[model samples]
Target: MGYVMQPSRPIDWIRNAIRYTRHSPKRLDVFKKCVKAEKIDSKALLCLDIPTRWNSTYKMLDRAQKIEKAFNAFDLAHPNYRNNLRDGVPKVTDWSYARKLRNLLELFKHKTNNASATKYVTVNMFYIEMMDIYTHIRNMKGIDPESRLMADAMQNKFDKYWGTNNKGLNYILYFAAILDPQSKLGVLSFGFACVFKAEKKERDQRGT
Candidate 1:
């Protein structure tokens, strides 16, 4: 996989754009008015992302995408829209990248929500969920070079945690998965074989 040493451009752009918009009452008002005019859901407000939380970034992008048309109109109606912003305003390409980022982050969002469910025991499911995350990060093919760079940066972090010496492949996780009736040893065996590229016999021996 490709390596990117810089910060994720799409995320940085979104963070700056949101901060810039929130700082300007006139721009924010125009955004709200446009949302109302467009008959978008009232909850579809442009939310600012918390620097610490990935899910909040997902929410910010999702909301921003919903109001993209409004931003487009605002840019056309106000010639000074871009100039007035403290940071550079988001362009159409930035908005498109946000949509792509949102889609990719949705998988993590859903996994996080599921893990947070209080009613069910989620321990056995964690192994599968983490594997899914690893697979998703590894398989990502971004829409453009910038998006690809962002994905590569994320993948690098994921690899640090899960790859190299297969540190993430703990026996406890497999044991927990095997103990769950819904996903027994057979499932664990198959999963190990696929992820580690181990032979079926080796996977079965490991499971045993």
Candidate 2:
């Protein structure tokens, strides 16, 4: 007979929610919108009859409850795998990475009126697409006949596109454009310059 290990439970999600909001009210607001987003429901409402502070407090708690439930399922299946930061290095699992990407996309999509979301969506979509191509190349790296086909496919995808350039430095510029849309696409480019550069470096080394 094989020994069975009971699944590890994550810290209570609702409790963590309270902690997060208590630490930063603004974060609570941001996550409320994100929760509404994943549920595809109507946006939270504000009533003229209610005090603004009380309204926000209620909404924040309500959102915390919902988010707590939503994450419980995801966490159970994925186990919240994280690296030991004390080791001065970090590692991530595909499940967590996939969830991160999805959550960011949801956040961007929910910010319907924010130009930053549009810009980020475009840049991140591009980066994820590029990663897909890079992943294929990596998977085929050591195989002879199979490698040629994958390389050809990657070349076609990279050479045939025409937005933001393949240099990938534009991802930072895109994020900057999000923060400062008034610049005509140049003002805050430097702000995210480091972000794109580091992402580019990391992109090159990521495994399939």
User: Each candidate: what lDDT?
Assistant: 0.69, 0.36
| lDDT for position 133 in model 1 | 76
lDDT (Cα, tens digit) per residue for candidate 2, span 102-121 = 33223223332233354444
Which residues of candidate 2, in runs, are more than 4 Å off?
1-106, 115-163, 166-186
Give me the candidate number with maximum TM-score.
Answer: 1
Runs in model 1 with CA error above 4 Å? 1-11, 24-26, 76-80, 141-148, 164-171, 198-208
Q: Give each prediction's root-mean-square deviation over alpha carbons.
A: 6.3, 17.9
For model 1, residues 1-208, the per-residue Cα lDDT tens digits are 2233246655676666666567678877876776677776757667786655668777888878887777766666656666765356777777777787788778878988988999988889977897787677656733567656656677666656555455555677667888999889888767756766633443496696
Ten contiguous residues with the weakest lDDT in model 2: 1-10
lDDT of 2 at 82: 13
Candidate 2 backbone collisions, by pair: none
